[model samples]
Target: MRDIIEIKRIGGNDVFTIGKIDIEIYKCVAEDIVTDEVIITDERIQHIKSRHPDDYEKYCKYMSEIVKNPEYIIEANKPRTALLLKSFEDEGIPFKTILRLVTSSDNITYKNSIITFMKINDKEWNRLIKNKKILYKSE
Candidate 1:
């Protein structure tokens, strides 16, 4: 069931507003080593749109697909975080999405959600490769 947070009367009509709703914008089983279910929420999309307009315009549609099947999965410096990357031949630049695995306060359920996504230059990609932080690479 979808959670409705607010109801406002607009033009004599009741309008529902959702705050921090758990509606799944995209859900898919990741092909990484862990193979966990990845979820992208509307809140996260707004974050991307506001923070990284250029990336949102260029790579928003590819976010779910990248998480579902990333070309490379690198271990992030933060615990329970991973950087999923996909490179397009035409673009040359790699698109990266930061995935964070968070455990609920009850400690029974988990959420693998994307914190943000952006395009990274070749230098950054090469540094990650050189550091050997990669956990998975597609064949």
Candidate 2:
């Protein structure tokens, strides 16, 4: 039996919580962390054609200009994962909950995002967790 059930929708993410465990489900948008630009895919192109046929050409021209630079619109899913992590931080949730998120297979945050927020999230205190002294080891 589940004691607590909570579902939260943020942006395009659906975060589910049963008891104390949280799981996030979301489609990652292609966003370039370097140039802070987003890549426009064919799906969006079709959407533009359907919604505003007259502007489709202009949109394509602009997208073409953006893609000229290789780093302008590279693909990355870290932003979606970062958003979920930030929500946990803002809510004053314990690291245990946040840890569950990264450990879960659903959303994987590379060492980059998690390590970046380490100090802010007090990651040094990971030793306080039960399994840390046994299972936790920094590589």
Candidate 3:
């Protein structure tokens, strides 16, 4: 059986509620080179579920793998954001995980949190590789 990464949730007062969704922080271990701990929030998951249910259903299971060992890490157009991408097979289609570095209310500490995941077409994949600065690429 393939190993599944452990994700822990922080609840109660630590949770943040926005709109109809209650957001909780989930912490998980990512591969080295990226930060050791990766955070994901419920709000982001809901955003994906509401906007791209098909992609969410298909790629949600691979969240850990994508974040832990992306084949390509590219700089996102938005500041403090990164695009982590990996393909499951030889096909050009790939799953992308968007990670954002959020500043805590204190304004000093920052945490890396996943914002969303989606499957991108080959053309878009090629464009990303061609236009963005690749931060890392696994051999």
Candidate 4:
């Protein structure tokens, strides 16, 4: 079996494939807010605080910067995206086909993460879905 792995976003809709798995991408959009000292209320921040309290302050500070200005995150995520694309190319998979399918789909509002789904050809699908009986005889 051949599998394709990569991430893509079309019309703000995010999609990705990993091996034979397919999924939809959902991004957590940070809301712009104003406060006296910038509260780090994101779940990620809390989680980091619990596990890495030593770095929690710095992590929260960084998260605040990301929330206040998202361009940094966008730039940071680009290189990771590029590496993922390279991985797919190395795997001999057609990443463009998946993007085309998502673009042609009716869904939008997904972005910035990788979701993967198993997409089998019609012949394979039929073979898998068809009812069959295995006969075994022991002598």
Candidate 5:
């Protein structure tokens, strides 16, 4: 018996069809490896735009704010803390969380609009956490 087959190629991959049976075959063979990746399409974009316009606008506004304030890209120091506080204020994230991440020692001081504190290196910070000198704020 001879069977008719329909083959379709989509997203740089080949799909084979024999009657109702569909199979995906690749040239390269590997064991226990993931091959297929999901691709987002224009239809999905239009659907999201139509359904969640407010969310899309909020994301754009947040990105714009970040672009406007380039100093937020710095490390976890006083200046960075101030920028993060501003970001938290805009995003409704708690200020205490931001403070906890930047505060290394109990010698944190505020002067005018800036906060100053001892900056701990990553190694020391890891050691402190390991010794339980300072509890991790995240639990």
Candidate 6:
């Protein structure tokens, strides 16, 4: 299965509401980077649930796993990392797997910090970075 990874830049940074696509400030905190700020918001959960009410119960069962082990989400003293932890938890991903990916990636904590939270290794990260497209898809 392919891992889904997407980044969106909210041009209307000031707007905070469920506009075209529902979105909530899922995570907002400080980061140790030149930007010094990171925000992780989820728009698909609600949209997905609304689109599939029959599976609401099933999805709830999966979402419950996120609360099962909070410690599984590691904290590397970075807001971006923490946000990624939450993302992993939402997807029902294991912390050990995330850690393993970290080791596989070269100094993930410093180089390509976001990759530490991603499923891709350092090589894939570099490849994706090189051919990345600037897509500002509107909801």
Model 2, global lDDT:
0.27
Clashes of each: 0, 0, 0, 11, 0, 0
lDDT by residue for model 3 over 22-118, one digit each (tens)?
A: 1121121122222334555666767888877787666666666676667887877776566877888854468877876443321343346678888
Task: Tell me each candidate's RMSD, in Å, in order.
Answer: 9.0, 19.7, 8.3, 19.9, 23.4, 15.6
In model 5, pairs of residues that clash are none
lDDT of 6 by residue, 1-139 (tens): 0121334445542211111111122112222222212222334334334654544334333232222222223333432343222224455433211211112223433212222222324464344334533112112
Model 1 per-residue lDDT tens digits across residues 15-118: 33322212222122222322244555566667878887877766665665676667877877776667777887776768878886543321343346678888
- 1-139, model 2: which lDDT tens digit per residue? 1211344454564433322211112112212222222223234335555755554453223222212221111122333332112213344422211121132333332111111111124463343433232221212
lDDT of each: 0.61, 0.27, 0.60, 0.24, 0.26, 0.28
Error of 4 at 58 (Å): 3.2
Residue-level lDDT of model 5, residues 1-139, one tens digit each, is 1221333454664332212100121111112222222122234334445754643333423322222232222233332232221123454422111111112232342111112112224464444335532211311
Total clashes in model 1, counting residue pairs 3 or more apart in sequence or in different chains: 0
Measured by lDDT, the strongest candidate is 1
Q: How far is 129's C-alpha from truth in model 2 (Å)?
A: 49
- Model 4 has a clash total of 11
* Model 2 CA deviation exceeding 4 Å by range: 1-37, 64-139
> Which 10-residue window of candidate 4 scores lowest in summed lDDT?
93-102
Find the 10 residues in a row with the least total lDDT in model 1: 20-29
Q: After superposition, how far is residue 116 of candidate 5 from its true place, in Å?
A: 42
| TM-score for predicted model 4 compared with the true structure | 0.20
Q: Estimate each model's TM-score.
A: 0.62, 0.22, 0.67, 0.20, 0.20, 0.20
Order candidates by lDDT, high to low.
Answer: 1, 3, 6, 2, 5, 4
